[model samples]
Target: MIHQGRLKEDSLMVMKIVGDAICANENQLRRYLSKRQSASKTSSTLKSLRKYGFVERHKSHLAFEEDDEISYKPPAPFTLGIGGYKLMNHLYPEHSFTQPEQWSKNSLAIQRYVAMNEMRCLSVEAGVLRGWSWNPYIGGSAKYRSPLAVAKLESPQGEIQLLMERPQMAQNFIGYYRTKLEVYRYLYERDKYFKIDGFSKANLQIVCLYVSSSSMAKFIQEEIRLHTFPFDIWLLSNEWISEEKGMSEAFCTVNQDGLKRIRIPFLAPKQM
Candidate 1:
């Protein structure tokens, strides 16, 4: 247990990262803290934070069937606890902080959340992630829809603004995807892009869709090709993101002729 006086700067930084992400696994945390501290130090700090109720562990199960019986797997993640929330609220009075609720046992939801956090960590390492907002409101009215996340990436050209979506590959997922696309198209036609507080009004540069498989990604590409939009639409899969280059991997987008592979301009090449 750490006393108030003993709570080090590293620990506070860990809490802030976790709070910003909503949840993060041990590996992601290590990557985020790599520049300032060693892996072993991060491990010990996490243990202390968990012990002192600054963070809570959540083990999401991966269900599978073997020999006609269902089984489960593990990769526990961490979220901010009550103490951490209170501390953040007190320290940053301008921003409202809420304690995260217990995550559902659904495997798909957990997987998507973990994958999003992985992208965020990778972006941080590449030094391109400027800002990230989870489920932020896009328009002033209630009729408008919100994307899964909004991010700003620093590029030589300028800041690359993205409205990101990651739909679950369920039976009716296509319908959901179409609806989300329509909403963005409507907003685009009306000249109303994302109006985030403390940021200048900017056009939506890209709509990034992160799917479950390469097949799904190809299908989404075809769907996007069928439509006309002012902004770019890109598709990436879990397989590609989990590869050696991670987010530095090329993403697929529709062009005038056909599908084309494009890389984010700002992402630095992965260090060997």
Candidate 2:
């Protein structure tokens, strides 16, 4: 049985943040708490939340790098626990909740989500509130299929929608890569009438931001160019994401005509 004592203000804040982001690891969650907050303190807060059945910690190994016959490396990531979902559902009735079935998907899925969220965060820093966040299960049906998300932006003359796609490991599986491209090809052809998010189809644009290392980014870029599919392509690196540069500088857009750069709409005033 749980007492349901008064929830601490910070705990509620953390729960909402995790809910908004879908999931966050310990360090990521702590960054929202305070830069000066120690790991032990954050752990304690998580412990309390877990004990109260408000959040659960998921153990994840995001990678397995083999440096030698005896040495291996792995990443530790977290997802919401059962209690966390309960709390999240209570707070955000507009959203549905589900725990990640396995970490294998996180290698690309979670990182993609994190990068998208980071971009949104930067937009928030610029004071823009109009956008959408999506889950892996985005879109209404299999035929329509979903990209990472659809961000609605207001340009100087009109509104535009930006579709986001982050390829997890495009080089290893040619079929998977082609399949995604084919889907995009389909969307590109019919975007003018594809009604998503209550807005007209003519305003939507797709941007596939590469989050992997430079080598992978290059490989993915070449793969897309080989197909010559029409859409905005960009390479989002850790260095660029860390700075306050507008989307134009942060993302190097690629096209057949050559690379083009454009400022991302809805950036904070300061960023503008």
Candidate 3:
């Protein structure tokens, strides 16, 4: 007798992480998986999950081999397929799973998130960040505007709210860029308050950490510098995932003061 409960628990943690991040690649999965497990076992388990239609992969392929006959190369990212969504509905009925259709359209967005999760995993290993919080407003109405994602990283210094965004890169880049800057400027200069939940406000150091193509990053940096925006913002390139140096080298932030490189233990995380 195959117990569905047991099957669900077999890779429950993996599902939670995938569902939370919207998607993740195998490399990111290994960080949260049990270190004692062998690589072969991990690959086999993932294969079985795919066979059962619990998870589906994105079009992009990673540069690695998974000891599987199904494909010569493994997929880059994986998300909850129809079956996986059903499992989630069974586990948490309070949440709705009626709209799995939208997940496919957001593949590019998921790619950016997968990269951010990789950075999150690295931060955990470096002992700089204890944990992070994914914005809870997803798939729901937001009372106020919010970042594409908000990661609250807790460190000994203090907590820092990393506003994650992957804005569209189009020919009329300036138009899109100005809209985002204006929104942040309003949040910074006008509101002067931070609210995570309905009630209560805790003023914390908020920094915009955007991930985009190198060309876009350069243009955005120039825009911020040329205009001399008063709010604090950071520009991260897609190459951030392949960076061999520390986080310090991976990003640069701009403000009225000037442009500067940013690292973890990010400049006293007190209320700004």
Candidate 4:
């Protein structure tokens, strides 16, 4: 996601200096910053550093010591650049949150966003998650339908979901979501591949994987319960899901592999 903020070279340079305090000089750093980004704002980068407690002004005739230089660290929810990792290892060698620990869901920024940021951008294809990791059940299924499929070009202020039948190879799901429903498009397609029967078609997105593990499905339900943007979360499955880690009963029975699907309706909670 593009942050609605700037990454000024000066600020980025300060980040570099903090990473390697011993070798960097301000003039060279300034040159580097000038080369990387076109100037957009003033010193908000410095202001941000000060706000995050990562910078300190030096006195004339600066005392020489490793700790005398800026000892700033990025905030817990902040994004990291290329140099931040080594600096993190140097400054916070023992901090638990710096690592990826499943049980400690909030440690890493990616983990926190994946697990706790219930604000999902899309849904998952059937039988993908809860399996041995890296299974491409995603692209396997034929073109499914959407639980919250977009129809009339909804508001531009909301997020964008790449409506797909399944996952694609080498795609960046870190910024996406997926979803699907069995029997959704198949029967719906008999007369309405384009929705003449007024039934919803099966669909998928890639962003749903970001939800915390135990509550992934529940997060989908709650989004429906509270009327989260896009559409209510739903899944499509057949015999493939008889033992699925989180599925109960889905739209149809898994049979011979074919380019087919069914329809399923997904709506927000009534009170919402």
User: Which candidate leads the pack in lDDT?
Assistant: 1
User: How displaced is residue 168 in candidate 4, in Å?
Assistant: 57
Give the total clashing residue pairs for model 1. 0
Residue-level lDDT of model 1, residues 1-272, one tens digit each, is: 35676677888888887777777788888888888889888888888998888888786653221123334444478878878888877777776554555454443565556668877776776778888878777655556778777778887787877777876423355677788888878776776565643456754478887765667666666665523766678776656664456666646777666566666645644573
Candidate 3 on 59-136: residue-level lDDT in tens? 653221113123334546777778878888788787544235665665445555676776666565454564455553
Q: How close is candidate 1 to the true structure, as a TM-score?
A: 0.82
Candidate 4: residue 161 lDDT (0-100): 32
Q: Which of the numbered candidates is closest to the native, going by highest TM-score?
A: 1
The predictions' CA RMSDs to the true structure, in order, are 3.8, 5.2, 7.1, 20.7
Measured on C-alpha atoms, candidate 4 has an lDDT of 0.30
Candidate 4: tens digits of C-alpha lDDT, residues 140-251: 2425333222211122233223222222222332222422333333433353333311223333222222222223333333333312323322323322232222222332
> Which stretch of 10 consecutive residues in model 3 shows the poorest summed lDDT?
62-71
Query: Per-prediction TM-score, please?
Result: 0.82, 0.69, 0.74, 0.19
Better TM-score candidate (1, 3): 1
Model 3 misplaced stretches (Cα beyond 4 Å) = 1-8, 34-39, 61-75, 94-99, 130-143, 168-174, 198-203, 212-216, 238-246, 255-258, 263-272
- Alpha carbon lDDT of residue 51, candidate 3? 77
Task: Find the 10 residues in a row with the least total lDDT in model 4.
Answer: 127-136
Alpha carbon lDDT of each predicted model: 0.70, 0.55, 0.56, 0.30
Cα RMSD (Å) between model 1 and the true structure? 3.8
